[model samples]
Target: MPSSAPVAAYPTSTRPVSIPGRKPRTQGLRNMELAFLVFAYVIVLAALLQVQLGVMGEFDFQLITVFGFLVALTVAMHLVLRFRAPQADPFLLPIATAINGLGISMIYRLDLVNPDITDGSVPNATAQMVFTGLGIGVGIAVLIALRNHRILQRYTYIFGAVSLVLLVLPLVPGLGVSEANARVWISVGPFNFQPGEIAKITLAIFFAGYLVTARESLSVVSRKFLGLRLPRMRDLGPILIVWAFCMGVLVFQRDLGTSLLYFGLFLVMIFVATGRLSWVLIGLALFVAGGTVAALNMEYVRKRIEGWINPFDPDFYEASGGSYQLVQGLFGMSNGGLVGTGLGQGRPDITPLAESDFIISALGEELGLAGLFAILAMYFILVSRALRIGHLGGDDFGRLLATGLGFVIGLQVFIVVGGVTRVIPLTGLTTPFLAAGGSSLVANWIIIALLLRLSDTIPNQATTRLEVTT
Candidate 1:
């Protein structure tokens, strides 16, 4: 037998195992980071209050209670989010909480100005507080239970069908509420439900599921003409049909904003997934044509266009006129030019639906231009983060879901802020997270939950895919 070669002893040194290409996951507490940010926000708000109320001598207990409650609820949400979704982006939840808190504060301030406007109510901050609690609870439940975004893909058609049913449900007899120039709400007992809010999320999921499977085919099956790549006419049939159907919904429901939102969101996701610009151009042309037609035919649409063009028209002040709300919104915003007239000082009562569509105007009036910019910056950051997460996600479904959700938020914010500022025709769309509607609140919270799920999967997604393949 040949003698075994002497084994060579290799020296070993202890060091953390580092993946060659991938970065190590950070262990910072995302929830704690969010809590600290929120705490800082409260401090800024308190400082503002100190300057306004302490200096001007207009402080009230109601304002203090509202701010205090918002801070408390934010802390509670942070606690719930800590254990539920530890890997979620630290900024999303805190930004959402800040927006919600600001909305409640604005609403409470408005209530103090004209008590009768709130229907003889003291303040509905408590109701919003309750809803925030419920929304956060639902968010945690979704994060804990769903486990993955792909699970939602299994029910894509079901969600779509249900969402469609809910969207059309308001058209049923004795169910819909025709308010704010649209019949989009369903009355269920004392609480009213906006089915469109739910519809947006469900349709988004369906869009993501469908697009992921078809992206490659759509990209390759294109006709090249004039040095531009366009999807084949046959391949475009489904998207066109969906667009027409959405247009029909807009025409019938008198909801141009949602129609624009859904159509734009669809086009964006498709373009991003397929890297196609032709679809975007086609969608824009269609939107422009549809907008012109609507402006010509619909009185409400025409009035909105005119209002945007000339909000300061004398005729707008007539009791039953188009510019009444817009003019009032302008006044409120102008009143809060720089640092705001203080939270409870500005006349937010001038604007109708100040707590919903025109909440930004109220914020501008009370919090000033600085506050308005801060709010917009928050939205920009949120959208940017969502997009970053989409790019980082390993799977097509996660990427599309996050992209679609981000598109929804960005588009909604643009539409609403533009409407309030009279930069575009007004449409009754609520601001995400900041608007005072239960459906909107719940929908946004669910969005946050989905993002958390996507973020959590990002680190291990590659290994999971490899394991499955092996």
Candidate 2:
């Protein structure tokens, strides 16, 4: 593509010549941001130590592994941004680091309670920190090499096909692992991963690229109904295909949460591309119909619905399909009250999967309602920053990609939180930074990378002030 092509994929800072007038410049505040990041690390490390001290009643030097992991992760990322992306967003890296560090702390606390595992491997806390480092490594790689977000657009079809394959891999014989009634994991030797987590990123790129090329055709409407434009029947083919795929995931993979996420992401991107309410209405109708049919025919879906609808019923509560986990999370949070019971003081380990799916409840029990609000506020800030980047993107492709990525984080959090609070049926999904899943951490960190790259493209004043007098 040409430097001045329709998308302007080249960096503005690289242009040797500019309009001759002087312009004000705003520095990227990179050093200030790095300082704040270090401060946040201090708090997180202290919190983790507090947990250890409370439980062990003594200072322990064995916490060096966690310290080394954080130092390596932060140093690697900090060096990358300083050399390669000095002008990127300041808050995102810090926010992610804090959330991820706190998650490890919570997991370590649970590890203390458990103390022993089936095969007697390393501690869950150490394993989680290792994954955290791996996640950071992916982000740094993306930042160093893929300086522009638009490059991914060139291979949209390839990414789309790969995403589809990843979604189906867990269904293959010997690879798929069925746990807690969801066959969404693939076991490779000793390692287990959810391909759907990686699929979210690839599929977002697919949706963005597909919509950008097809928006002109999909945007036009021949008929108006009640002052709203309804998408043409011919234009609806793409969404129908995606919707059907999501239904397939629901049926074959038995992962209702991932299916809902895929469908919701596509729906949002289509609406943003076409500015049509009719598409959303149609998309929602399809999901509801598909979900209803699945609920009737699929025993797992039926059980999920029954559990959501009647959690307290005598037979249902005690049955294998019961909402015991949900109810227990609620109780744990309630026990937390206004302020938390303090770290290591409460028993969040009592809940099933407290380190992954129900990490929020674990935090709630230890950190209290007030602490949860603070944590949520941090998430709100992170999402808002990503959306702000999307809003300022110069081209449709960048705009849509940023929007889709931001919504990926927001929607996942809402789904996990809503499920815990009983606002929606429980779907077994990992919490973003707060969960103990490596796939989720890696995927989310890559998202952070993309957002940083996207933000870098929107020229700050400093980027445009390089014009010389000639």
Candidate 3:
């Protein structure tokens, strides 16, 4: 009886609980994010300092102001995420900041050596700095206000309308500004804006919301053709409309890059949402056919194609629309060799439009093949993380939206970088973040903002399971 009474008082275990399928989202990793920003700032500042010393024989004191401005802007956005988007991915902002900072430095370097700049005219670097601040401001506003990405779905058609308007704005009589044979820009007083840049973001939102609603019909109501599941004629309506829209952009807007980019984004998103390869095949067919037909008729298109085919040909160099820039860029990169010519030491300014269209070449000339690879690796990493978030996203709209946005970045990089490297035709597309353009910067930063917000909404499986058990 005494032994039984003594055995009745056992203690319970107090070990840490491990939920079977839970991965809690308790840690924000804000410190880690800030550390990356600091590292990126150091690299940017060091590069700029080298450029000043290498070319100007001393440090540009203005860079100190630029550095302070960028750091403050980044910190402001960081605080927004810390409070508003606590679960957002930590690396996106830092990566973007690094690319952007490097771009600004490169532009400044090019500006310092630009013999083309008139005595009283503003340097592109100063303008780029202003744009960077504006872009960061826009991004911060988006992050602080947008608590949920799905709210975009509510204005799906509205986004479509807005995108349409923006696209057409460049085609308007007085507003449209034709530069370098691409009429995808609008002039507002002294400032020229590429409305198509913003259009891409709005169109992605529209495509995501639209496809999610139509996925059922587009996926199941299809026929097998030549061992592939091809959507029925009625089900093919959306893709067909998209193809026509792409062609319209190419023809009217005169932007082969933007047209190809939009179509590619839609085609990939459709396939992802429906698990159908037919859409891709069909889209490629449409693009090739449309592009070939346009090339045969359009003077600009023909020149671009010919240039890509033989950039080094003297005919290409001496033509009305010569590939002198392309040839010059190739020579610059070739001169860079393995490591680099050391930032300010190279003749990056010799290439036409070196700050924007040929910025990759400018970067390649100074950083060399190894550095170019590192920069591309950063872009690939960002795209991979975005895809990861999308694949893990539970909601169809969020998944599609995230995936589409990621593709926009990936495909655009391919188009622009490929053009620079002679892997594809010159398409007048600016490199994201690294190229000098305010509209591109603003649009891209907004995309980063949306992606961060979406990541915040994605729940951790461990947290979900733990909460359920509790």
Model 2 agreement with the true structure over 140-180: per-residue lDDT tens digits: 99998997778999999999999999998998888999663
Each model's number of backbone clashes?
0, 0, 2
**What RMSD, rounded to one decimal, does every model reach?**
5.0, 6.7, 3.7
lDDT of 1 at 356: 77
Q: lDDT per residue, candidate 3, 246-308, as tens digits?
A: 899999878899999999999999999899888899899999999999999998899999998
Candidate 3 residues lying further than 4 Å off, grouped into runs, are 1-28, 178-180, 461-470
Ranking of predictions according to lDDT = 3, 2, 1
List the lowest-lDDT window of 10 residues for candidate 1: 461-470
Which ranking of candidates, highest TM-score first?
Answer: 3, 2, 1
The candidate that wins on TM-score is 3
Write candidate 1's Cα lDDT for 1-470 as tens digits: 98797744753444444455643333355535665666757754764465346334765555566566556655665665556656667778777877776676665555555557556643555666667777777877887788667888888778778868977988888888866468788898888888888788888898888888888778874568787798888787767877886787788888889898889889989898889888888788887888889889988788778877877777765637668888888898998999898766667877888877888898898789998898899899989989988999878988998989988999999999998887778888999888777888888888887887787677643221111110
Listed in order, each prediction's TM-score against the native is 0.87, 0.92, 0.93
The parts of candidate 1 lying over 4 Å away from their true place are 1-26, 31-77, 117-122, 460-470
Per-model lDDT? 0.77, 0.86, 0.88
Q: Please give the lDDT score for candidate 2.
A: 0.86
